[model samples]
Target chain A: MTVTDEYLSNNADYAAEFSGPLPLPPSRNVAVLACMDARLDVYRILGLKDGEAHVIRNAGGVVTDDEIRSLAISQRLLGTKEIILIHHTDCGMLTFSDDDFKRGIQDEIGIKPTWSAEAFPDLEEDVRQSLRRIENNPFVTKTESLRGFVFDVATGKLNEVTAS
Target chain B: MTVTDEYLSNNADYAAEFSGPLPLPPSRNVAVLACMDARLDVYRILGLKDGEAHVIRNAGGVVTDDEIRSLAISQRLLGTKEIILIHHTDCGMLTFSDDDFKRGIQDEIGIKPTWSAEAFPDLEEDVRQSLRRIENNPFVTKTESLRGFVFDVATGKLNEVTAS
Candidate 1:
């Protein structure tokens, strides 16, 4: 069976015990932007219950225009005031440079992507960079508490990254 | 304490019972793109263990350049082959139009966002839209299986959206 089918079978069990149809807005008034790393389970790490917070994730958890779009929607329409950004140790984003990645794709496909691959060499600096992007953005104005962290994959611990 | 502080406290407990770092690549070879809805816990819904599948999310669970970037990275760098797209019931994206959301932001701040708010009128159609976007994208070329679904909030079941 395809892995999707295997997960579909798992869903039958999830549905049997499911109690949902919660309110549309996030109960915790928070939104989390995190990396799409397989190891970082944002819900359990933050002790978040279902319907508590909006969880937005991507490759590096970097703040691109789309992330700004998601954050704006979270804060303005949904009443989410707090924003949390999570980048992890040993991230794929840190493993390669943007130019090299795009060049590799170009060599294969004969066309380069116009968008930034958003690879970073440093973790904490990138976390701070994400924090600053939100801080300076015009659309995401409803944030009351904004912070960033680096999640250690080995210990499953979140270490706060302060803006330098 | 702020909610962030409360979550930080929870992190301590998570770390207490934490395990060592798993491999960087997803074990399941799958990547799921879902909504940043408060209710849908993508990991539990899909029965994904930590280090199994990469989960990428955003406001509407829609595909954009950022998602293409993430999926490309997932397929090329991390070796994920299957792509699953999920949009849930009672989505906020269904509540408004792109024009109205942008107009409200424009009225509040003199500068309107240049990005699309990505509001949609229908759920299943949008799911298909996301699927088609992935199919059409040039960067994300490593897919072996691609499917889209709408997750029912009340029943906690995922009903597949077949191409029409």
Candidate 2:
């Protein structure tokens, strides 16, 4: 069996106890933009139940244009009003420079990608920058309640980045 | 106190039990792209542990340019070799057209976004398209193991989308 088949069978076990008619709009009226790091469990870290908030993740949790597109729908169409941007320590994004990665790709693939990796040096700075990106976007509806955070993967502690 | 403060306190409670030296490379050598829908638990649905797979989520799990960048990093920088793209039934992407959403944004903010919402009418077709996208990208390594699935929100079952 493939991994998906295993998941299909495993989901049968999860489905046995599944009780969901979960609402479309999250209960907290919030959306979380976090990193795709496996160590950070946004649900367990924030005590979010199944339907409490929309969790949007990418490589570094950077607020890219696509993320803004998602947040646009999250706020205008789905009624999510608050935005939480979370980055983490020890991120893979911190490990590489954009140019180096791009050049490496050029070497391997014979073509350079137009898109950026959006890697950053400092975690807290990236969190602040992401918050500012959301706050400054005209498409995003709920900007005033934006909060940025950096979760330490080692200690599992979340530290809020104060707005500058 | 803000919701973030509350989350910090809650995380303190969780951090008390934190035991992680989770490796950088996911044990499964896999990455999953799924939706930002609140109801879908990618981990529980796929039975992934903390250090097993990178989960890259966005609005519709669409294979955006940013997603391709992330996958490039996931394969070249990190050690992830396999990818699973999952969209779901009853998705918010199915709820609105790009033009409608852009018009709404223009009405509210006096500006039209160049970015498409990446919305689609059909789920399985979207999954197949995303799989094809990964397979076609030259920057992405390990294209052989790419798979796609549609997770049912109501039933908690994953139905694999067979590649054409």
Q: Encode model 2's per-residue lDDT on B82-117: one tens digit a residue.
A: 788888888989988999989888988799999998
**Model 2, range A130-157, lDDT digits (tens) per residue?**
9788878888876547888888888888
Q: After superposition, how far is residue B86 of candidate 2 from its true place, in Å?
A: 1.5
How large is the C-alpha RMSD of every model relative to the true structure? 0.6, 1.5
Q: Over the stretch B1-164, how does candidate 1's per-residue lDDT look in tens digits? A: 68999999999999999988899999999999999999999989989999999999999999999999999999999999999999999999999888988898999988899999999999999999999999999999999999999999999999999987
Query: Which ten-residue region of model 2 chain B has the weakest summed lDDT?
Result: B1-10
Give the CAPRI class of candidate 1: high
CA shift of A160, model 1, Å: 0.6
Tell me the native contact fraction for each prediction. 0.84, 0.60
For model 1, how does the per-residue alpha-carbon lDDT over A1-164 read when each residue is reduced to its tens digit?
89999999999999999997899999999999999999989999999999999999999999999999999999889999999999999999999999999999999999999999999999999999999999999999888999999999999899999888
lDDT of 2 at B82: 74
Candidate 1 ranges with C-alpha deviation above 4 Å: none
The 10-residue segment with the lowest total lDDT in model 1 chain A: A134-143
Weakest ten-residue segment in model 1 chain B by summed lDDT: B96-105
